[model samples]
Target: MLAITRSLPLRIPTRLFSTTPISLSGHSKWSTIKHDKAKNDAEKNKIANKFSNAIAVATKLGGSDPSHNVRLATAIENAQKNNVLKKVIEQAIKRGAGIGSEKKNVDTALYEGVGPGGVSFVVESLTDNKTRTIGLVRSAFTKAGGSLSPTLYQFDRRGLIVIEKGELTFDDIFEKVIEVGAEDLEEIEGEDFIEIITDPSDTGKIADELKKEFTIKEVGISYIPKEDMLVDISDEDTKIKYDKFIAALEEISDVTDYYSNLKNEE
Candidate 1:
């Protein structure tokens, strides 16, 4: 699945899965509370893990000083906005900075694979063990009847920045981003944010300029497919495999983000 940072105004054309539960009759009050709490805790842990990896990556990429590292500053800002604890943030920084015995080596890893229906994918993970991460990724693909292959050539690497719309109009952000040399600017209908695509080298410069007047929701390099491949989800077998593949990828904690060429068509 393509990971979209902000909500778009356009309605989604496809329903991957039904979120509504089929039955809730078997639950007691305490059981419900326990289930809810567990879900919430799991969500919180996922957020923490993502931010921790991001912070560590930013620090490793440009050192521990946020003042000198735009990516680090952005990562820290995003983490704080997500309510990640101060101590956790600091620990992540230390891990990246390689401070003391508590520090662990972390690296960014990428895996290229195919999903159900010949959908090409580029999966990114921030992990301490490449072997373990690759194993998990390969298993996901194999389970879905897909396989790892050379797929990076099917996409382009670009810097994608998502900015909150706030009180600004589409023209408002569009004009500003154009002035900053953004490659593309888009405001989808029904979305409350603007997306700006820029050259990898200009991401920090554009993001820094926008921060003075806009709320930056996300700033990172993303893989965009050269073309969209429509996958036939109407077939029961295809749909089942698609769901299975997506679930497997989601379960891998190290998999931070993924990009795919699969298109959901009406």
Candidate 2:
């Protein structure tokens, strides 16, 4: 169902790497309490693992003090929002600060892949082992009838900010975002939130300016797709495969964030 007029440049190795298979069954049965518990536990673990890495990365980038380091503050805020335990958050900070025996060198890497239905993926991961991380990523894509490839050409790197839509309408906020030098603004209907996109280098400064009036919810850089490169998956089979592909990625402990060129499903 996925059609490509031209051959996509592949980044996969000469031979496929092996990883433990991800059972799609874990996803198909969500009605029973037993299944629900398993899924909820997995989701919580994923959230905790991701925020732990994020906190560690932010602390290493700036300092552990949230007041002094905007990035660290954002990471901690997001962790707390997701209900990450206070002790886990503190431990991650200590590890990042090299103040604990658990401290280890952490590195961040980006991976590009083409998923089912020609959707391009950009995965950001923080890990101590690049070899193991790549192997898991590559296996996920392959098992989902996709492959690792050069998909960055189809996307642009940008900063994304989310803030409370408080008292202001979309027009009201658009004016403020433009005045703050953001590149674009989008209203999240029914969510009382607005998203502002900006040049990656300007994210922090713009966020600071906007924070004077708005409650900032999230601040981060993202890989956004070029208009012409967006993929739409209408076929049910391809959709199923894509969902499973995403689930597999979510189960990987090292992956922190992922981006895609898929259009919003209607």
Q: Per-residue lDDT tens digits of candidate 2, residues 176-216?
A: 89998998888765788877888999998898788789988
lDDT per residue (tens digit) for residues 1-266 in model 1: 23233111111123344576555676678987998899879867766877877788778767999877777787888889878899989998988887865366778899998888787888888788899999999999998999999888878888888889888777877888889889887774577977788898889888888888888777778887764443345677887787678767766877777777666421
Q: Lowest-scoring 10 consecutive residues by lDDT in candidate 1?
A: 5-14
lDDT of 2 at 31: 51
Error of 2 at 196 (Å): 0.6
TM-score of each: 0.82, 0.82
Off by over 4 Å in 2: 1-39
lDDT (CA) for every model shown? 0.76, 0.78
Candidate 2, residue 144: the lDDT equals 93
Best by lDDT: 2
Error of 2 at 30 (Å): 19
